[model samples]
Target: MADRVLVTGGTGKTGRLVADGLVWRGIDARSATRRPFSADQVRFDWADDTTHDAALDGVSSVYLVAPTDRIDHLAAMRPFLERAVARVPGRLVLLSASSLDRNGPMMGEVHGWLDAHTSRWTVLRPSWFMQNLTTQHLPSILEDGCIYSATADGRVPFIDAADIAAVAVAALCDLVPPSGDHVLTGPEAMSYDEVASAITEVIGRPVRHCRLTTRELAARYTAFGLPEDYATTLALMDETIATGAEDRTTGEVERMTGRPATTLASFLTGQRAVLGSAGF
Candidate 1:
């Protein structure tokens, strides 16, 4: 029998792409989700302990993706991770963020724990996801014809999630696991204004980037009914951007995938509809 790899956030952006890539390469991939599906999926919920065993059963590799929306994610993952490493002797490729090392607080906590606990591990510290322009917050831009944010004169090397997934798949499948962390990024770093301009060019529409104060941005999110903590977290992330943390790119993607990472313009052109759709 072929070795099975368990994808924790199988339905997520990077997870879905990684799972599909594995399947395309003829690997027997298993998807773990809260709800069951027709595909080779296991009913797994991060909040539920009972679902852990079945998800880890016969799995040689696991893609650890944390649910970013939850603040208690580290606490929730600790026990589950303890169970996994104890039961399965395999690679644990954790999907983390760039610059969020063991010293960066929340994400850093998870990064630190996994670094110490798992014998065979790979940390994917990717820059800002390009999908944020299409799947998540792009609609607000398209709907209002403006991208609103708290990032002030901050340039981020926005990376493609697909590129991150590709690197992850390589790490997950290699016979000899690569030691240490891989900082992934796109071809170049670009600012929000530049990114917005590129999207406007591709979609042939006028989309503007609106800069807001952190407090004002948090207030806007709060008005949208997001919890105070989440709103504050969003505000903090935007503030972090202003510090030039995401202003660098790395050669890790090209090294792992045997190809250079996609540029924001290329990503935007391919996802023109998503970037231009108000209902997306």
Candidate 2:
């Protein structure tokens, strides 16, 4: 039988895609969600330790995604991870951020711990996801025909989540064992304004990009009903964006997947309808 792989945050965007990719390759993959997910897999929750054993049972690999916006997330994730490592004795592929190398607050904690953890593991430190612009944030932009953010002159090699998933699949199945962090990015770097222009070119709509102050961005997030700390963290991420931290591409995805990473224009073209829509 194929070795079972457990996926944390499996219902999430990247996690779901990674799980699907594993399944497509005829690998035994299971998704772990907060509550009982409807898919034909074991239900698990990080908040509840009782669910861990059943999920990790017979699993030879795990795709780990820590909770966001927590600077000390390593402690919170430690219990679950310790249990999984001790019990499963398999590969652990952690989903981390590329910005962690520069001491970015929240992601850095997870990055630090994962790097030091002595086990068979692979860390996927991907740049800002192209999906964020299309799947999550584009609705608001499309509604007003303008996207508001704090990023000003920052350029980021926004990566495709599908590419990240593909890399995860390779890491999980490869026999040589996964090692070191894989910093993945798209083919090129582009600023938010450039990203907006790409959307306009694909959708044939005049989409405007607006740069806001960090405080203003925090206020906007607060108005959207997110908690204060989370809002501040998001604003800080935007500030990091404004600093041009993510303005670089890497060959990690191509090295693993044997294909060039998808471009922003290509991603926008595939997601033009969603970008044109006002609601999800």
Candidate 3:
């Protein structure tokens, strides 16, 4: 029988695509969401231990997506991960961020733990997702025709979540899974200003990037109902980008998936309808 892969956060941005890609590759992909979206998706929550066994049942490989509600996410995830490593036989792939160093903070702690514990594991540390413009930041963009950020003039190789998913599929399916972390990025680095211009050109709308101080950005996130500390941490991430930490490109996407990374322009062109729509 083909390996059964458990995809945590299967309804989420990248995890959904990962599950789809695995299915397309003729792999048995089981989506593990908090609520089952389909009969195929198993209910799994990192904070809830009750859902773990059913999700892990008959599953060989696992795709790990950390819960986003808390900054100290490692604490919440530790129990489930311990169970996963103890139970699952195939490789484990973790979804982490490029800005976060291994063994540093948040998902980094998970990264460190995976390295020390799992014999077959791969950590995907991808740069900012281009989907952010279409999903996370789309609300403000549609309502105000502006992109807000603390990363002043910072350039990011904004990768498509699709590319990240492809890489994850490769890691999960490979006979010999890559053991270390992979820093995935797009073909080129682009600033928020350039991203705004691209969206404006694609949608024929007057969109602009509104640069804000870290404190202002944090306050904006807090206003949007995010916890104060989580909001502040997000703002700090942008501030880190502003310091030129994320202003580089990598070929890991092509190396792993045998295809060039998706360009921001192509992503924006494909998302033009969403960008121009009144309801996103």
Error of 3 at 196 (Å): 0.9
Report lDDT per candidate: 0.82, 0.79, 0.90
Per-candidate TM equals: 0.94, 0.92, 0.97
Question: Per-residue CA lDDT of candidate 2, range 1-280, in tens?
Answer: 2378888888886888888988898987798887754764677766677888888888888899887535466766777887876777667888888877623455566556655665577788899898888655776677877778898989889999999999888888863356577789999998888888887787787887888999999999889887888888778888998887777888888889888889888888888777877533
79-169: candidate 1 lDDT, tens digit per residue: 7789878876778888888867764556677777877776677888998899988766766776777778788878888899999989888
TM-score of 1: 0.94
Count backbone clashes in candidate 2.
0
How many clashes show up per model? 0, 0, 0
Q: In lDDT terms, which candidate is top?
A: 3
Candidate 3: regions farther than 4 A off: none
Clashes of 3: 0
Mind giving the per-residue lDDT tens digits that candidate 3 earns over 101-126?
A: 88989999999998888777889999
Off by over 4 Å in 1: 175-177, 278-280
Measured on C-alpha atoms, candidate 1 has an lDDT of 0.82
Best by TM-score: 3
lDDT of 2 at 151: 86
